[model samples]
Target: MTTEVIKKPPTWFWVVSVIALLWNLMGVGSYLMDAYVSIEQLEAMSQEMRELYEGRPAWVTACFAVAVFGGTLASIALLLRKKWARPVFIISLIAAIAQFTHWLFMTNSVEVYGTGVYIMPILVIAFGVYLVLFAKKGIANGWLK
Candidate 1:
């Protein structure tokens, strides 16, 4: 009998994994800050975030944090080729869409910050594509089995 050892994932996979790690770490830190920070600090952070988002609601900000947490876990699982990562990634994509929708429809303002404000839509689209591609890759690599 012969045994075969599979090769490692592609370099891009590792690169994505690193990005995911950063996302997850940031997500966790935000939650911690939201919980432990002083009211003034929270307000300051919220103000900064609002400026970036053009007056998006506070609930949207919280949901965005949840999505980041999901994405971070999914990304880590992807590194280990865990089966649940695909579903988590899908959930993250849906959450991202929901987050974007909050910005597009529910948000009270239309005054985009600057020329680069269009990047928000582009980021959502990129996240959607990333979710699809990584989900397929996860399945192909036996991560979803």
Candidate 2:
């Protein structure tokens, strides 16, 4: 039997992978701060916002954990040239969607935070989908193994 050899990816692949890693690291930092937000910080929020935060379901919190942590792990996997990055990124996207769903449906986030809050969620979904597709493209093009 013959074995297949793959060519090295171009400079853009490394560039994108590093950017993805840094982006996900920011998500991780955001999650840590959200999880550990101080009482003073909580009190500083508007009453509606405070209620939204204090009343969040535990499962939604878990989804936030899964979304950021999974994305970070997927970014690391991508940089390491691991084929597992695709599925892990897909999982991260699903968790992100779930978190967004909670914000859009289970709570009055829009009513409270107004239209500006939509930007971050939209970016989160876009970036999550982009990373998953990027990983898939990497695998298909033999940049990942």
Candidate 3:
């Protein structure tokens, strides 16, 4: 008896996967820069926003960086349909939710200037759900590996 394997993805999957990789890579770069650089760098980017370093918590920064790196690695594994994709995606899903919560619940009620529009929060929620559920279909179907 031979086990049949599914092969190849729809063209859209390739397109979405590329988009997801680019998105995750940006997260990796932003988190890395924020965690390592001085507050002056962030202040220069946003002069109105005050730094909230809370004792300069290294652990918090490390964990945040790890979450971003996990997403980056998962996006890479996704291209190959590696088994690690699901767990990595899961981590990203949770982190995305946590980030969404922080923005929605923890931020000040007063709006900051140049926050890049209010629609960003909604887009993030939509993208988080899409990446977690639909993006991994190829991995499940054995087309990714």
Candidate 4:
């Protein structure tokens, strides 16, 4: 019987994986908050913000859930040094792209929240892409099994 060997990942790999997990956990928190904002919390928002939040389409919210949830799972997989992290990251990236596409193009988020709103979404997308590439590299380098 043939056997496959897995190499030990470098320290930086562990560091990055932990950071990714924390980041995606924050994303999951954001998604949860958005999904279950209380009436008091909603009322606390400015009119523009409240309207924007309430007006978001269900599909966009669904994408948000998938993106954050998928990324969180992928991060966990990465921490476990699982090769499946790559595809999970890819799925998360796709969902992130879809969610941001609605926010950037299908809505007046920029007009309502100004250009400042662009920063977080851009960062989210970039990080998602980085994670995908990182997972792929881990697989290629035999760091993931």
TM-score of each: 0.65, 0.96, 0.71, 0.95
Q: What is the lDDT of candidate 4?
A: 0.92
Give the per-residue lDDT of model 4 (tens digit) for 1-145. Answer: 9877899999999999999999999999999888889999998999988888989889899999989999999999998989999999999899999999999888888998899989998999999989999999999999999
What's model 4's lDDT at 129? 89
Best candidate according to lDDT: 4
Model 1, residue 106: displacement in angstroms? Answer: 1.8
For lDDT, candidate 1 versus 4, the one ahead is 4
RMSD of 2: 1.1
Candidate 3's C-alpha runs over 4 A off are 1-4, 42-48, 51-63, 109-118
The TM-score ranking, best first, is 2, 4, 3, 1
**lDDT of predicted model 1:** 0.67
Tens-place lDDT digits, model 3, residues 6-86 = 687778777877787898798788786666777666666543354343433455555556557777787777776566676
Model 2: residue 76 alpha-carbon error in angstroms = 0.7
Look at candidate 3 and give me any clashing residue pairs.
none
> How good is model 4 by TM-score?
0.95
For candidate 2, give the lDDT of residue 116.
88
Error of 2 at 43 (Å): 1.6
Where does candidate 4 stray beyond 4 Å? none
In Å, residue 127's CA in model 2 sits off its true spot by 1.0
